[model samples]
Structures are given as C-alpha cells and as structure tokens.
Target: MHGSRSGRHRSDPGVAAAAGDSGLKPKGPSTLQALTDLVRLVGRSNAPQLRLRLVGAVLLTLAGKALGVLAPLVLGAAVNSLASGQGTAAAVGWGFGGFAVGWALVRLLSSTAPQLADVVFAPVRSAAQRRAATETFAHALSLSLDFHQTKRSGSLSRTMERGARSVDFLLRILAFNLVPTGVELVLAAGVLGARYDWRFGAVAVVVVAVYTASTFALSNWRLEHRRTMNTADTEAAGVSVDALLNYETVKSFGAEARSAAVYDRALGDYTRAALKANSSLALLNMIQAGIMNLGLGVMAVMAGFEAAAGRMGPGDVMAAVLIMISLYAPLNILGFAYREVRQSFIDMEEMLKVTRQTPQVADAPGAVALAKDTARRGGSIAFEDVGFRHDARANGLEGVSFNAAPGTTTALVGPSGAGKSTIVKLALRLLDPQGGRVLIDGHDVRDVTQASLRTAVALVPQDVALFNDTIRANIGFARPDADEAAIWAAAEAAELTAFIRDLPEGLDTRVGERGLKLSGGERQRVGIARALLADPCILILDEATSALDSRTEAAIQKTLRKVRAGRTTLVVAHRLSTIADADQILVLKAGRIVERGAHHELVAHVGGEYAALWRKQTRGARART
Candidate 1:
C-alpha cells in the first residue's frame, strides 16, 4: 500500500527553488534547529508535504502519551483497592480491564502513526530524491569535457547512488524515531511529578538525565567507528566495480590472482571496521541495561518505605513502577536512533556537495538562439587565435588560428597527443576556449543556447558508442522522428543497409551494450548513418573510419565526398590515404600547427611533418598487403 503511493509522485517539480539556497548551516544551536532547517528545505515549494505529515505525527504522539498516563493510573487504582481490603470484586475487575484498554490504545497510536507517516512522506521523499539525481546528471552533462576526462565512471556512479538513498533514511528517522522519543520524554516527566512525591519525580529526572548523557557519549564513539566502516564499504564497492568492468583486460593478462588479492584487501578492511562498530554497540547496550536496572531498584525501595509509613498506597507504587517501565522502552531505542541520525548526516553531506555545485556552463540571461545561415555564404567555422588548457594541465592547444570556408573540407593530420582532437572539440563547442573565441556562421558559440549548438553540429567519434537497443533505434538516435524511408536512405549511403537487412530481425535486432553485438566496422558505419540522418550544417569525423578495412574505408570516403557539396566538414585522420585528396591539410605537433597546405604540396616538402607521416602510413599499408 505504501509502495503504491510512492509510485504516484514521480513528476518533476517544474519550479525549483533557486539552486544552492538551501541555507544549511553546520553551526546550529540544537537538534531542533537542524531538523527545522532540513524540513524547510524539503518543503520549500510544496508546503503540504511536510505540514500534513508533521501535524499527523505530532497528534499521534500526543495520543500515545495520553494513553500511557491513563494506563498507569488504572493499574494504581486496582492495587490500592485490593490493599485497602475492599470487599468488591467487580470494581477491581473493572480497573484491570480499563488498564488493558488504555495500554492497547497506547500501542496502537504509537505504532500505527509511524507506519502512516511512512506512507504519507514516502512519495514526497522519492520525488525530491529523483529531482536531485536528475539535476546532478544534467549538470554533469553540461560540464566541460575535461572534467569528464579526469573522473572515473564507477566512483561517480557510487557517489550519486548513495547520495540519493540518504533522503529515505533521513525521513524515516525524523518521522518515526525523533518525534516519538521527544513526546515520551515529556510525558514521563509530567506523570512522575503529578502523581508521586517530588523525591520520586527527582529520581525519574536524574535517571533520565544520566541515561541521555550516557547514550550520547557511547553513540558518538560508535559513530566514528561506523564512519570508518562506510569508507571501507565504498572502497570495496569501487574495487569490485572496476574489476568487473575491466574483466576482459584482466583475463587477457592472466591477472586473476592479482585481482583476487586486491579484492581480498578491500574485504578485509570492511570486515575489520564492521567488527569494531558492532563490538562498541554491544558495550554501550550493557551500560544502558545497568543504569536502567539500578533506577528501577531505587524506585522499588522508595515505594516500600512510603507504604510502610502509611503515606503512600500500594496503588501509588504500581502507578510509579508502570510509568517508569513505559518510559524506559523508548529510552532503550534512543541510543541506536542517535547513532543512525549521525550516520544520516554524513550521507546528507555527500548529496549536498553535488546539489550545491554550480555548473560551469549555464545559459546567460536573454541569450540569443543560434540560427543557421542558408545564404550564399553559410556553414563556415572560424577560430580566432584560440588558446586552451585543462584545469589540471598546462597545455592542450596554444595560439591556434584557422578557418574552414563554406562548402569545403579541412583535414587535420597529426600524431596522437598533438591537439588534433582538441581542435575538433572546439569546433563542436564541447569545451570553450580559455583565451579566444569559436565562431559558427559569424556567431560566438557561447552567446547561443546549448540546444542550438548541438543541433548545428554532428560528431562521429573515433570509438563510436551505441546503446543496447534496436539497430534502427541506434541509427535513428540523431533524429528519432525520422521515417523508415529516411532511415533506410541514410543506412544505404553509409553502406550498412545490406548487412542490417540480412539479420533475421532486420533493423529490429538488439545491438547490445556499446554495440558489442556488431563488429568494429559495423559500429562505425552506424555512427556515420546517425550523423547523416541529422544533416547538421557542420560535420566532424575524428578518425571515423579508422576501425574499418581498406575497402570499407574507401567506400565510406566516397560516400563522404558526395555529401560534402554544401556543408563544412572537418576531418581528423591518421591514415594519409584517407585525406590525400582533401582541399587542404593542417599538420600539428606539440599543440601548434607546424605546416598547412594542399596535400600534394605538403608531400613535396621532403622535410615537412606531413610528408614524413605520409611515408610512414604508405609503408605500413604495403607491409599489411
């Protein structure tokens, strides 16, 4: 029943409270203030989500306290009547029966209210958590490509997963454990003072004070140990995920024993940390038991003295004893609850780090939409003395200037790590240049919207990535609304239509993760088909045909020639044969362009870098044949 409602609140809150204004301060005076701040955050736009559950939970708590106070009084009355030697069985029986009913109400109200809270707040918590995850993921997508290049996928995934799950634990502690314990504390103190003498009330006060202090101290000790445990668990999870992802590499190198040794170290750390946490909790429980028993013993002796002096009746003793027992039950849980609340804060902090981040790229106020030019002069790319570097590195590209006129092919030829890819990335606006500007059709890329920029360019990567879906879906990814005929036309142009048609399910066959079901050449062709379907103004091929055989590479090159009539095409290739007929080729070395000219002219300069690369590539082709 609770799960049913949780599924209903999955819609995104369209109007987000401005990001990072949650006003969470670590320097709070009391737990109450911290809880209030957290509640205010979760309830910023949707006031009803917190208000309804909070009111219901408080009312239920009052109901439980009221029943608890009454049950003890009834038990006291029955004991007094019997002690006074009243010759009335009906009266005593009625007293006992009333106590039973009151006890039942206490149990029902306390237990049922928390369960109801879970049902009510479950949906709201889930929605908030979903919003947080989506916002983080979208922010990551908008971040500069250099940020992604330095981070590990497995670690990032674990961080987000744990951060989202933290909300559920926090809600449960707030709704059920924290609220009820507070109510129980107030009711116990009130009952002791009202019905018994101040001495007895003082006993209740001192014992409760000591119990709370002890719980706090022991819980803090255990919390430190639990933090260690959590670290070990995260490390273990990271190692396992990394090993599983690189299983093929490990197997090829016969590193099974080495992998096992690493996994065992992670597991050993986790086990040691867990054992320390459990042992500390067990010690804390023993202290709690000792304090509770001693308090009860003192109360028992005091009641006996009062009875002997004829100042207090047997009923008073019964009432005092029952009240103490009732209070002790919740007190027992307080230690563990405090520990959990502390752990929850650690989890919450991880989530806040992601939510509080400001994305490097955000749309400016009143930003202009990018418009494509279809006049006689259209689809041109220009780089004006651009300089770039990753945040952690000193150099990526420096003082580079270039232009690709409309309706022409500009090829960049360079060895690996020579900044050829960086130039292509700059043209696609994947990363903004640190020192200069990239212009598309005479408009700065930063001045336009991200959606418009993405729509204006299509990139074919060296390693084409495909989702585990139908072949048709993978090819039509650029334009999901493309009709069957348009998809078939693009596939035909890329020379992939015949192979797709030969499959039993034709285009419906599942490609599997990263297109594992297809060969390297087939995946490259699918990527080309996707790019062709988009038909963007600027096309980028970054070693797009490097994975194919000579024949397949020649076929794709011929197809590209026909499609390059009126579009700006930028090619980054290692094979000189692929770009031998390009209108112009730029040779790059160590983040600088050392040579730029027609291919034949570059080859004629025997000392030029492009000429050396062409000689090496041609020699490799001869050896392969």
Candidate 2:
C-alpha cells in the first residue's frame, strides 16, 4: 500500500503526529565539506593496523621524493668528477664508478618507494570503500516505503557504486599524486636554492603555483559538464533497468522499439555531455603541459648562462635541468588528478544526500516488543476511527473503524479507490493512520517494536514477488530456521506438492527474477507457502487465490480454511464468489463502509451495493460459462 500524509497541520492532535516531511529534498554536500567528512571518517575508523599502514605510506612517499631530488645532484657530481680528468686511470675509474653506483641506488629506490606505499595502503583504501557502500546500502534499506516508492532503484544503485569508486579514486590520486606532489615540489625548490642558485628556486615556485591555480580553476569550470554527464548516465541506466524489469509489459504491448528509442535518446544526451567534459579535460592537460615546458625552458636558460660564466660546471647545469624534469613528472598527472578529484567530490556529495535522508516512519523511542494475548488462539485487530489521506487520492480511509476478533475472518470488499488496501496497510502498521490508532492483540501497534508487529502479521499480496533463487530458498526466506518438514508441510497444504514433485529439481528449482519463471498461479501458491511458513496470528490474503483456475482455487479455499482456523484472517477480495462464505463482510465505497453483514444478509438487501456487485459478478461468471 502507498504512504499517506496528514491533511491537517503539525499542531493537530491524534495520529497526524506520525506523519513527517519525507518529501523534503536534501542538498548535496560541498567539496570542502566532503573533504572534512572524509578526514573525520578516517579518524573514527580507529583501526591500529590501518593507522600503521597509513603512516608507513606517508613516510615512504616522503622518502621517495627526497631521494628523487638528491639523485640528480649525485649524478651531476659523478659527471663533474669524470670530466675533471686530473687523476690516474684507476683513480678516475674508482671516483666516477662510486658516484655512478650511488646515483643508480638512489634513483632505483626513488621509483620503488611509491609502489611499496601503494601496496601497503591497498587494505586501507579497500576497507573505506567497503564500509561506505555497506553502510549506505543498509541505511537505504532502513528508509520508509515513501522514500523507496519515489526512488529509482537502478539510479540509487548507480549513485552508491560511483560514490564508492570515487572514494577509492580520491584516496589513491590525492595520497599518491596530489599530496605527494606538493611535498616533492617544496623539496625540489629547496634543493635548487641550496645547491646552485636561488633564482632556480624562485622560478620553480612561480611555475608550480601558476600550474596548480590554472588546473584548479579549469577543473572547477568543467564540473558542470561532468555533473550533466553523470545525470545522463544515471538516467540511461535507470531507463534500461526499468525496461528490462517490465519486459513482460513491453512484450505485451510490442513496445520494444519504444524502449530502445528511449534508451538511445538517453545515450545521445550522455554522449554530448561526455564530449564536453572530455574536451575540457584535454584543454586542461594541454595548458598544464605548456606551463611545465615553459618553466623548464626558463631554468635551462639560467643554467646555460651560469655555466657559460664559469659559475657552474656542465654537470651542475645538467643536474639543474634533470631536477626540474623530475618535478614536472608529478605535475604531469596533476591535471588528471584535479579533474578526477572534482568529479569524486560530486559523487561523494550525492551519496551523502541519500545517507542523510530521514525516514518518514521511524520507531518510537522506548518502544517495546508486542505482547500478544496468550489466552486467545489468534490475535485480534482493531481500528478506532482511523483516518488517512494520500497526497494523490482525494478519498482515503476516513473516520473508519472496524474489528476482527480472535479466530475469526473479516473480509474487505470494495470498488477501486475505496481504501481496502489502505485498510490492510493500516492493520499492518505500514502506514500509521492520521486520526486514530490501530491495536493488535489489544496493544497499540505504534507502541510496539515494528519487528514484533511484523512477527504477528503475515501478508500475501496480490502480485507475489520472489527472489531469483531456488524454490526452497524463497519459502525458507520467511523463517530461515524453519526445517525441511515444516517447509514441505506448508507447500503440501498450499497444493504445491504435486507441482514440486513433477519438477526436475523439485524444491531446488530456481525461480527467475521476480519469480517470472513460474506461472501466475504457481507464484501465488509460492506466496501462500511462504506466508504459511511464517504462521502468523494475523494472516492477510489480498486476492490470494485470484490467479488460480476454479479447481485449483477451490482446493486452495479448502486449504485456507484450515490455515485460518486459529488465525484472524483479513481478506481483501475482488471476486464476490471468493468471500461469499466469509464470517463477516464489509462493503466499502469511497473509503467508507456502506454495508456490514454476512454475505447472505448483504445479498438479500434489494438494490444495495453488495447485492449489485454480487449480481454483476454472478452474471459475468454465467456468461463466461
């Protein structure tokens, strides 16, 4: 059943207090806020091993940068010594060989350090991604039906996947690329100033600053394009999933062409958006490369002048250029990192928006488990002047009140939009009434834990949905610990024993998505089996046997009587013949019960709603025969 909202103000007394502003759309987090949140999350992780790996990664990154900066100087010294040519053959060989070996060792370690760091940090990054996805998924499941009804499952899943991937990307690129690059830049500048000339240091700082600033500005400008692309991607994914899930409907109407056209249009939008984003990224990369090469040119010119004037050797000039080249390597990836980091922040923000949404229906503080009436064989249900109004419906349950005593059956029959389903939802506390309370076993449902209420009620919806798993798994899902005998007994009672016995795999036969592999009647029987396995005090059969043929329906009807013997059964029926023998029948119109009596008594009324419906159904059946 759909969710309902209060037709009155917040100050209104009664069950209107249970309604909340679930429709309030929340804003996504900003980049700075996302960064802060990630920092806090890492701190809160509090894993000693994670902290140790993090620390090792940082220390190793620094060591790699330092060694990289020093390697050029060592190589330059070796070049200068060999060039001097002022010693014996063996002396020169020893001097140059020692310097060459030292340089090779430093350079070898420099390249190896970052790899080791990545290896050590792998666990931490994976753990973060797992925690993010798991927690967000769990939270999404906890959200009320109102939020879920309005949400696109595929889009939500895409958001979660992108968010988790973005976290991994940010950790890898920021830690290994951006942050380490900054440290490398500072160390390179310091080495330049302290070794050859301060002019080299000054030029390095200016060029790096310009490159960083320009990359940041351009990446920010490209953010809108990326956002558009992401939106289109999500929309495309959602369309494909919806089309596939409703494959039967599409096939029924021969609408495959329409679905394909819709998907093509979505892809077209995504392609255009992606083109813009990628083109801008290409431009950013070109600009970054230009700045680095120009900086290198300036350093080379300064070094050439210094060497010409005898203030620096050929080796020193070579060392200076090599140092600048080493610095540019990390900056080379800087453009890519900036673009990805910006995109990642957007993804993270979207995930945060979903995680932050408040559930419209939440458990009350200090709520306890439902205390069933032990003396009775079945639990009783009562609605006291209950009222509800859906936003899209003009008529909903209004000042409606009814009761089904223990061990009795109450049937609700009504025209479309007459609130039969709404009544069922209210009984199960899926949606709290706006004006009154619902009691189960003489205890207010709202006052008890939702889990406990769920334990006492079982529902078999009109369209039964099952997971893509074995038949045994779907039935056992209702009660995981239910043993084999109990499951077989329930299936046998539901008239599924013959069907399963004939199947090649029996209970192990796998049902396709939403149990579409089975026929309507078969799925309905599966639903009945699952509900019977639950063995709740309150059994809700909403058109439970609507899909079966007459013979099968008759058989199930007899089985249902046995199942409902000691249970308070609530039947929402459309076929008048189905509920003709119900203990008490309520005929509803426009959300109000217009007649209440046994089926015989209601049919005896001349020109009444129940009498009219029964005559029409009976005539339709006769005509079919």
Candidate 3:
C-alpha cells in the first residue's frame, strides 16, 4: 500500500517547483510608482479637520516668506537714507528704527510659522505612521506559516520599524521643508528681477541650477553605497538576535567564539560600506560649499562693478548679498533632504515587499461562522482523499483518508516522516489540503471562519512554546476571560497543581523565554493545562506525552482517558505503549495507512506491518528489562 501510494500520488511538477518562493527578494516598484503610492498612503487619512489644518499651514508658510522677503528691502532703504547727504538726523533715526523692527518681525514670523505648522500637522503625521505600521503588521500575521518559517524574525521586525519611520520623515520633509523651500526660491528670484537688474536674477537662477544638478548627480552615485550598508547592517542585527535567542545552544556546543566570528564578519562588511558612504558624503559637501561660495563671489563682484559704474547703490549690494544668504539656508537643506529622501524611498520599498505578498490562505468572502453548539457531543472529523506536498523531495500525505467518530479516541501510529503532523495541521485548517477536503461535523472546514473553527478545537503539541510571562497568564491565554478558579481546576486535571504550589511565586512565577526556565515535562504539562482550560470539543495530542517520564506518562495517560470520556480525542504517537487501548489504531507507513484495527487485532495479524512494529517494540522492552 505504501509503494502504491507513492506511485499514485506524485506531486504536480508545477506546484512542487513554486513551493520555495518566499517573496523576500527586494523587487520594488519603479521610483515614480513608489512616490505616488507613498503620497496616497499619507493622504489616506481623510479627516476633514486635517485638511483645514493643512490649509492653515500653507497660508502661514506664504505669509512668513513674504515678511522675510520684505525685511531686506527695508534694511536696504535704511542704508540708503544713511548714505544720502540731504537726509536729516530725524529721517535717519526713523529709517534705522523701521529697519530694526522689520528685521525682528520677519525673523519672528519665519521661525513661528514652521513651529505652528508642526502643531497643526502633528496628529496627521502620527495617524499615518500608526496606520502604516498596523496594516503591515496585520497583513504579516495573516500570511501563511511557510513565509514566516523562511524569514528571519529580526530582519522582518527591522523592516517594519525602519519603514514606518521613513514615512514620517518623508511627510515632514515634503510638507514643511521641500515645498516651502521651493516657494522661497521663487520669491527670491522674483524680487531680484523686479527690484534689481535682470542679470542679478539670472545669476541667482544659475547658482540654484548648478547647485541642484551637482547634488543630484553625486547623491545618485552614493545610493549604491547606502544600500550596501543597510544590507550589511540588517544582516549583522539578524545574526546577533539569532545567536542571543539560541544562547543555550551556543553554550552547549561551545560555539561562542564561532558566533562572535560570524558577527564580526558581518560588522566588517558594514564598516567598509559605511566608510564609503561617509567619504562620498564629504565629497558632496565640499562640492556644494564650492558652488555656493563661487556664486556669492560672482554676485558680489558684479554688485561692486555696478556701484562703481553708477548703475546701483551700496545699499542695493547689501540687499542682494542678504537675499543670497537667506537663500543659502534652504539650499543647504536641499542636499541633505534629497539624499535622505532617496534612502527613505528604499526603506519604504522594503516594507512594501512584505505587504505585497499574497496570503496563501484567507477567509473566503461571505464565509459563514462555525456553529459551536453543533459539537456539543463531539465534532466528527474526516479527511476525504486529502493530499499535500511540502516540496518535491519531502514526504507528504497522498490519498490519505480517515474518520474519527464523535466521542471516540483514534490513534495514528507512524514513522517519523509519515505525515502525522501534517494531518493534524490540516484538521486545524492551518494548511489547506491542495487536493481534497477536510470536514468537521459534516461541514467543510474551509467554508467557515478560521477564528471560530480554531476556538472549537485545541491541540497539545510535542514542543510547547510559552511567552515570557507568568504561569497564570500563559494558562489563561487559552481563554483570556477564564476565571482564576477555573484555571486552578484545569491545572489540577493536568497534575500540575502540586508543582505550582511548590514554586516561590506559585502561578505568578515568570516563565523565561519560550519557557526555558521550566523542565521539558513541566512545559508539556503546562501545555496540557492550557488546552484543557479551553474546554474544546475536540482534543488533539500530537506526541503530547513524548517528553514525560514513564511515571508522568502513566499519570497523564490516566488523565487523558478520563478526559476522553466526553470529548473526541485524536492521538498521534510514536510510543506504541501509549495508544495500545485506543478504540481504533491506524498504522501509517510512507504516506498510506497500511494497517487499521484494534491494537490486539493488528498485533495478531501474522507478518503484518503493525505486528512487525509490535514485535520490534516488545523485543526492545525485554532487552531494557
């Protein structure tokens, strides 16, 4: 039967070929597309009040710029009044007073506008950041188990953090800095053209054009270095987190030096990339300074020539120089802003990669909720010719069919790779069968909502993972609203009451990361207690007693038998002794059920697979004795 199963249930070449595609590679959209998407994401917060605030911010920006531009003109007029021989002392005093007041007021408005804009837009920026993070996180959780398995947790977490921060930075730069700077540039050019010579305006335009072109060219060249640095940084962080998470493994193998070497190598790569990026940055800054100073020199020399030629006054030169100086502030920021903006786009694109992955499993539109009351007795489960394949090389179930009647215990005994755990996951709807249907209480499992279905079933796996929290909290996780009394009752059923009472903090004791603070048997017992607390209609024990000692196993077996009286139980066991008395025993080999019957009936069949397995175990028991 096993040989026939393999031949008849070969996986399709197409499905097997695509099984390893995890969608982690950085295949980001075009720059234009990314910018458009980011803009839309920021503006998605459709608050009418936010729109009003945005308008107010824009108005303040324009008013501040106008005031700033008018200040230099007033200063120039005061300088002209001082130079004029026909002007009286009173006129000079009035000119000086007006200049001082204008300068102070312009500085006040220029500084005040951005601060007020920040206040008005604070809520909008925060909302956008929160929305982006929440949606990305929720989408990540909804993805299939396969994707999570292939991804590094630390790297994934970093992507989310960096991505959200990038969005906030981009919004602030575009709204308050980039747009306002452009407006200021235009106003400065207009003033030079209308109030001064057209040559002055042309010089201003040339300076800006040259500065912008040089910054962009250099920034684009530095982009590859930044990307390399980010990659190395992410890799180093992932390695450190992975090593720390498996600290015990490192200690046991005496591989601390090896881990350190790996980490150092990653850091070395990062160091090289960072040095290159910093060097490029210095080069960009030097070139930018040269351009700005050169422009100022040319403008000043021209102003002096015009004054000597009687075409302009000394005050006009002061005004031209002042306007250029004011323009310097925004221009300086423009270089930094452009570089950071490009890097921000890269960060956002990495996050978008995660969000773009289509979930392998999702609830169908208009899916109905599971009827909890229908399984009052027990939920009857059936696999109708179910099939699945992890990959072409890995063994998976094929043409496997079975039925567990309500209020009965069924045991599946199989070798290590016989698809026992796969069957369990399929029953839970964690992985949908590619070729067949799984049913609970005569209804298709996929037809109902996953949340409702999962609530009705509880599983106790071989390896129990616990949060870094208190024992009471972990147990109560199965049913968050469960009363303390109910929690104690479940603990008692799992034979964990005495253990808890002996602890210093009792139920309040903290379980270290993944419950490493507890022994193997203790963790398994806690898992059993949590499952029992749920009071699920169907209980699945996937090698649940594998870690227990002989004595603890016996005790747990007794508890299991007592619990099996009302609820339907499905046991996947490697220890044949644990399931000897199960109502029905299915012997699986490769991916097929080669033998099926009561334990005694299968063991009595001459030369059968079950009999051979029973003899092997019996001989081993005698040898141990």
Pick the lDDT winner: 2
For model 1, residues 351-435, the per-residue Cα lDDT tens digits are 4565666656656677687887565233888888888876655657888888888878899988787899889888887777887
Instruction: Give candidate 3's error at residue 246 in angstroms.
Output: 1.7
Runs off by more than 4 Å, candidate 3: 1-28, 46-48
**What C-alpha RMSD separates each model from the true structure?**
6.4, 8.5, 9.1
Candidate 2 backbone collisions, by pair: none
The lowest-lDDT stretch of 10 consecutive residues in candidate 3 is: 10-19
True lDDT of residue 162, candidate 1: 54
TM-score of 1: 0.87
Model 3 Cα lDDT, one tens digit per residue, 1-625: 0101111111000000000113233444577987887877768855448778878877877777666677777777667766764678887888777877777777787778778878887777887778778778988998987788778787788778777877888888888878887788788889988888888888998998999999888877876665676566666667789999999999999999999999989888867876676777778878888999999999999889988998777788888888888887777766667767766676777777788998777788887887774536878889899999886436778888888998888999878888888888898888899988999888888898888888888999999999999999999999999999999999998989999999999999999999999999999999999999998888999999999999989998999899887678899998888999998988888887888889999988979988888889989999999
Ranking by TM-score: 2, 3, 1
Higher-lDDT candidate of 2 and 3: 2
lDDT of each: 0.74, 0.83, 0.81
Clashes of each: 0, 0, 0
Off by over 4 Å in 1: 1-37, 44-50, 78-87, 310-315, 373-378, 391-394, 483-485
